[model samples]
Target: MALPVLVLAVRWVMMIMGSDPRAVGLSAEPIDYTINYLGLWAIRFLILSLAITPLRTWARWSWLAPLRRPLGLWAFACALLHLSVYFLLDQLGSFSLLWESVAKHPFILLGMAAFTLLLPLALTSTRGAIRRIGARRWQALHRLVYLAAIFTAIHFILRVKGFQPEPWIYAGVAAVLLLVRALPTAWVRRA
Candidate 1:
């Protein structure tokens, strides 16, 4: 599952390790590509993570239920890597540059806000944490993932110019996932 991200990291490192990095093709284009790739994977895993409840409740796929935690964790990991690549490689590890980006591009702030929301959820995802926080409270708190996904959708939309179907499709998927989760489970059950 993590091997693709590992491979991407290795390729990114290899491309940027030398002084003549541009000669080796370490340029804005590849950085943008990598950033896009990371963001896509983050969104993908996030949707998958959010889908488990609906699947378990409506489809009664108890066997697939255990995957929820791991999927959410991977979503967080990919999102973190997405932020890291932007902050580290794209901005050259400059906080000022990042802030400047936030000022210049609203999407950066949206992305950061999404990440901020995910932090607590990631921190308290464990069984022990749930025990400490109480399952009801933990479940309530984890619902923040919906807000995070919304912010991510806006960020993605702003990142692109004019109109594109891709970001909107992801946003629509996020919306449908939320809708399904909100539905009365007793009203609809399929075998």
Candidate 2:
């Protein structure tokens, strides 16, 4: 809470100073750079939240399980900021232009798709919703996160306009995460 608030304040100061956050080794946009990083934090923590299930089940860390929902909500909150920045600042309130960019820019499209998927998952993260849907159905709904990850990678990759190490790192992490669930089912013997 305090961290994000402080970061936002600093971002405003930097933007007012007319400094490029990325040029200063901060972020791409000095004004909204902090929000961008917050978005990244959201995505990273979302991934981390998903891993908690596997960690608890496989590694037997029951304590980590409790953190999932809160982290997921935090991720969602940050995602909202990310999208807000994209629309309000990046797109400059041009829905038409935003749609145009989605059609023309593969990265924008992929990222938009990823965020779209995340929207539903976040909405259903409540305890009442979980109880109403039950575990199996809820689990199925949340599985969209994996697809969201792929889209996110494509988003990052295309945004770079060429090969970049950072996107590859994200891709690799998402791959390992998906594989964890996949390898088990693949190894199951039909008796």
Candidate 3:
């Protein structure tokens, strides 16, 4: 599960360090490439995490629920990497630039909001943390991933130059996954 995340992180590191400045499937600019690549992946993992429970029910695969933890953590890592690249490379480690971006760009604010929401979820995604927090409270807290995904979707769409179907497709997937959760259990189980 972590293998893909590890490889992607390494590749991003290499890109940032000039070892591989060309982004294969993303923007030509390294900073934009890193930021966009990581941002999209962050949202992907987040939506995948959100899909676990619903998939478990729909498929009658109880084992699927355990997959959410690692996916959520990966999503959190991607989000952290995305923000780190922007702050470190794009902002040149300047707080003033970060603040300026936040002020001037609503997309940046949305991205920050999504990251803020995922922080606690990732931090507490462990058996020990679950035990300490109590199962019920922990479940409630982790539900923030859904909101995080929404914010990420919005951030992704807004960060681009104009309306594009790709970001909209992501948003659509997030919405469908969320809708699945709101569905009646009996109805979902029948599907």
Residue 85 lDDT, candidate 1, scale 0-100: 86
Q: Candidate 3: worst 10 consecutive residues by lDDT?
A: 19-28
Candidate 1 stretches with Cα past 4 Å from truth are 13-28
Candidates 1 and 3 compared: the better one by lDDT is: 1
Q: Model 3, which residues run further than 4 Å from truth? A: 3-5, 9-20, 23-28
Which tens-of-lDDT digit does each residue in 1-191 have in candidate 3? Answer: 56655666677677667764555333457568767777878888888888888888888778887788888888898889889988998999999999998888888898998999998987898899999999999989988888888889999888777667998998999999998889999987776
In the range 4-67, model 1's lDDT, one tens digit per residue, is: 5886767678776743434444455677877888888888888888888888888888888888
Backbone clash tally (model 3): 0
The TM-scores of all predictions, comma-separated, are 0.87, 0.81, 0.88
Q: What is the lDDT of residue 191 in candidate 2?
A: 14
Rank by lDDT, highest first: 1, 3, 2
The alpha-carbon lDDT assigned to residue 188 of candidate 1 equals: 61
Checking candidate 1 for backbone clashes, the offending pairs are: none
lDDT pick, better of 2 and 3: 3
